[model samples]
Target chain A: MKKEHFQENCYVSGHTACAGCGQSMAVRIVMNTAGKDTIASNATGCLEVFSSKAPESAFGVPWIHSLFENSAAVASGVETALVHQGKKEGINVIAQAGDGGTADIGLQALSGMLERGHDVLFVCYDNEAYMNTGIQRSGSTPFSASTTTSPSGKHSTGNPRPKKPMVEICAAHHIPYSATSSIANPKDIEIKVKKALKIKGPKYLQIHVPCPLGWRSDPSQSIDVAKKAVETGLYPIVEYEYGKLTKSRKISSPKPVSEYLKLQGRFRHLLKDAKALAEVQQVADKNIEYYGLK
Target chain B: MAQAAKLCRPGVIAAYPITPQTHIVENLSQFIADGELDAKSVNVESEHSAASCVLGSQAAGVRSFTCSSSQGLILMSEVLFCIAGMRLPVMLVCANRALSAPINIWNDQQDSIAVRDAGWIQLYAENNQEAVDLIIASHKIAEDPKVMLPAMVCVDGFILTHGMEVVDIPEQKDVDEFLPPYNPPYKLDPKNPMSFGLLGTPDVYLETRYAIQKTLGDVLKMIPTVGKEYQDKFGRDSLRLIEEYKTDDAETILIAMGSVCGTIKDVVDSQRKQGKKVGLLKIVSYRPFPKQAIKKALDSAKNIGVIDKDISLGSDGALYSEVKSVISSDKKISGFIAGLGGRDIKAKTVEEIINLSEKEENSCRFIDLNKNILWEEFKTI
Candidate 1:
């Protein structure tokens, strides 16, 4: 009923997440904003694993987990059921998955849900890699970020592929709402969720949650690292409504991507290579131009 | 079957186009479009999403339905296990078809049989009438308080899906009287919230699995009760776990499932006229396998032949293996692989198996398979 009630009544405490789990924090903000009248279909990921480990659960709201790739489909089902029971009046349906679940295994399902115009909010807690599966590289992993699957070895660098453009993909579906947020600004997450919830159709919110364990960032500076990601114009906080860009979190005092890269060990190797650092800087410059973050 | 679904009043129907299963969904879609069935029809892109959508709907405390076959079933295989594991009771109709590789789109038991281990209660149909009956019965069994497990009502691909037979589709009013409204034991309600389908560690993973297995074991007893209730309401008696025919003084019996059983029955009646003392045992329930019923049905037989439309590659037939394990008789029951890839199981094939069961020293036999054609490739390999 109230904004604070979401935090108090939705996702509760008591689980075994790592010290700096941005997925948990971003998810808490997302679920809390979703309020008490919400049912979540979660994909297999850090949030799914940490929040509700059998016999004990941190969730105060009703939640379910299907496969990693089918959360949107499952949520579509839940939404239909709610409407059938005439309970969709106040109930909010949310599907949450990690980066890999979203940009890779779950993309088709997400696209299907959006195209069907189902009233559900899909949240992708972008931790960059598969942290729940022991830090494997995922589709959401940034280029040159080290992961177990994409090691920065003598002969090779880390991931060579750029992070999949998930927000653009959501917009391509011509859905009612799509947004990018950062856990550093929990208010932004809360604002986007409130805005998206009121619009009745498929909505996507990709929150840049800095995973300290996966990214090799400082546990205490997880929020700070996330802030730097947005401040550097690399992870732009923007919103779109029905395919038109509506809002962009301005980069008034723009910093280099080096500042963001320095905070995480995943990009630690990039610091020494000027060519890699310039490549990462070019990514930031492109985002600034494309999103008008400047 | 579509009428049965309409009667049950499924809240959501996920329709994905696939062979054999397409006609069933098309009928439902037409019904919904005409306002005959008040249900949300989600035209999902794939079978995987179809399964997931139903799983979500059931988890959200409403009844839902979906159907598929062959490659579609294989596509849905992943979500099938998830629904069962999460204990969300779903009613899935699998029009069984053969797997591709010759890319054949025809009848066989391979589709549903392939997912036997996915933790759904599988019911085989002998005809279109039986298929319709099992649809309503499966919903009852799946929603039973004691048996909160998913169920699959399987009809042979084209044999029953394409074949039109007279079925007394239950009236909406009567069905409403029979089946209670969807009030899930645990639902995603904000008023009374609870977490579901959590990550299970090694300490509790096996325990969660054992819980489902225990519930499946519990289904063994509840199926007959539910079957009896469905019979009482619908006035159909043979929807029982197994359909037994003239095994009283039989020396040899033939065991099979789905529409092929109809042909087997015709053969058994003729064999009885010759005073051959042969019978047919049609297994209706495959999962929570009716072991006691199976043993009781063929208890008097001196020899038994298990007919399977789907082979398990290097092993024998899927049902044949299960039947052999539970028979309590000597491992002497012969396994016959027949009617694969939509190949018709003529009365002659049934007669051949009956004769083979009598004389053969228990072994696997590929009935009607041309050895010269099949073995030619084997010779090269």
Candidate 2:
């Protein structure tokens, strides 16, 4: 179990994910970081549907998919079983879910897993909406973004609410470590995962993974869009320990929110509505001011 | 039920707090705290997570248990189907209670009866002692290699779960001899990395369900052998598909499940003293339905009456409908809906059902209905 051993490709190729699928990229990074002695409990979303379809699997480690909203609970059970079997010394348990599963439906189980202090790491792939169900608006969907359920219309704009502060909510559980990473920064994700796994208690890491199908971005620009999201201070990459902010990624030469929103068709309608566009910019401004990212 | 599970030496147990089932989990936690049990007890946030937690532990190759009632069981219904579909031998004790809309926290068979088709072995207990016996036997039966399906032991909410009873709990060493450590055929292991609960494409989905259906067919034969083995070790004739009382030369037999059979047996004894040729047929296993065993049990009787604590709403009782599905068309069969929502099913009610079956043919009737409520609703209609 050296770090170099974990760098080996545990998430091998040959799957059905989209060409620039951010979730599958993040999963490959995660599984490689977790190494071969790890077990994954996957939620029912794009990652599960694409990675393990029937007799085919992209994972080299043991993996299980129970339901859409019980990944964290299932991971907790796996960790407890390892302890009961007296084999919890060198294994890592990780539960991963999509944005909708994390911020909305699976929140309770995640909270229970954290509050009970299970030795597991929970990862949330923040793709902004329910992309598997054709881009329905979710709690984590950004403000003024067009989704199937929150399409722009005469009576209303697109999604009216801002993206939920899921990392803050998870940090409020007083877990040992909580951090936010992005698919744009693979090294940062690996470092944060290694750091979180060393704490010996429940840890939370939410990775900002762009969805090309749902966000309607260019297939090859997933990393570019994710980098712009972090550069614009819309998706802050920060770390917390014991409910206090320990580190925040400083945005050098901060970009405007429009630079990030223009790359995705979901926010194209906001470019015409100045007021809505300003509201979305204000969201980025508030995050930069609060997290001291600039 | 908690004591029985503890005796079985489960590796992991998880449960959330709901009425009637609350005490079972509490007792289990106490066992863990007192060092009497070496297990991990997860105090989950909801019944959904409770069921999911055990499903995970059991899938990881360990014996696991969970308990719930009423709305809690309803919340766990989604994961219950997953546990069975994945073919995990997870054990659950359902303290049966009524469903909501009126929100009654009382005794009924609706909760467990509602999820009978979730692909778990459904066992109904006649009393607290039988509930314990069923819990122990469920693990052995569900963990069998040929029949690796989840099992739920159903007990009446307040009547069996809340009531105190003198039960002959088996010793831990004896239970150890009865149920060995669960050796899962497949598991989430690093040494042998295999995936579980994968998506079933159209080419493979039908065969997966057909496999469970075929396994349950094997379970129907395995349950009685397990019950006989349990009796040989425990000295009690419990854990059978169905129990017969004085049905040999009887002309009328009243059929029911759960604790109401006690009242029916008492009524049968008094009716037999009066030379009425009355008998009782108690159903224990409800999921497999035991069509052959039930049909054979009602052979000598001329009139068959089925008493159900839960109804199917538009149709007759769930038990009555199943009984009618099996027996021949010529039999004088009747259905009686009784003891719903913790309503008492006294000896008099059983006597009324026995007398009603003698004259009624192909009728489903409701016992102990208030005439005033019926008249008021009639006028409104």
Worst 10 residues of 1 chain B by lDDT: B372-381
lDDT of 1 by residue, B1-381 (tens): 787777888888996999888988999999999999888899998999999999988888888899999999999999999989888889989988889898888999998988999889999989888887888877877887767888899988888888878888877777887788777678778787777787778998898778888887877787778778878888986457788888888779889998998998899898888888999888888887888888888888889999998888988888888888877656358999898898988999888888889886555677786656766666442
Question: How many angstroms is residue B256 displaced in model 1 relative to the true structure, after the best TM-score fit?
Answer: 0.3
Clashing pairs in 2: none
Q: Give the DockQ (2 decimals) of all models.
A: 0.83, 0.81
User: Chain A only: TM-score of every candidate?
Assistant: 0.96, 0.96
Candidate 1 Cα RMSD (Å): 2.3
Q: Which of the CAPRI classes, incorrect, acceptable, medium or high, describes model 2?
A: high
Model 1, residue pairs in steric clash: none
- Evaluated with DockQ, which candidate comes out highest? 1
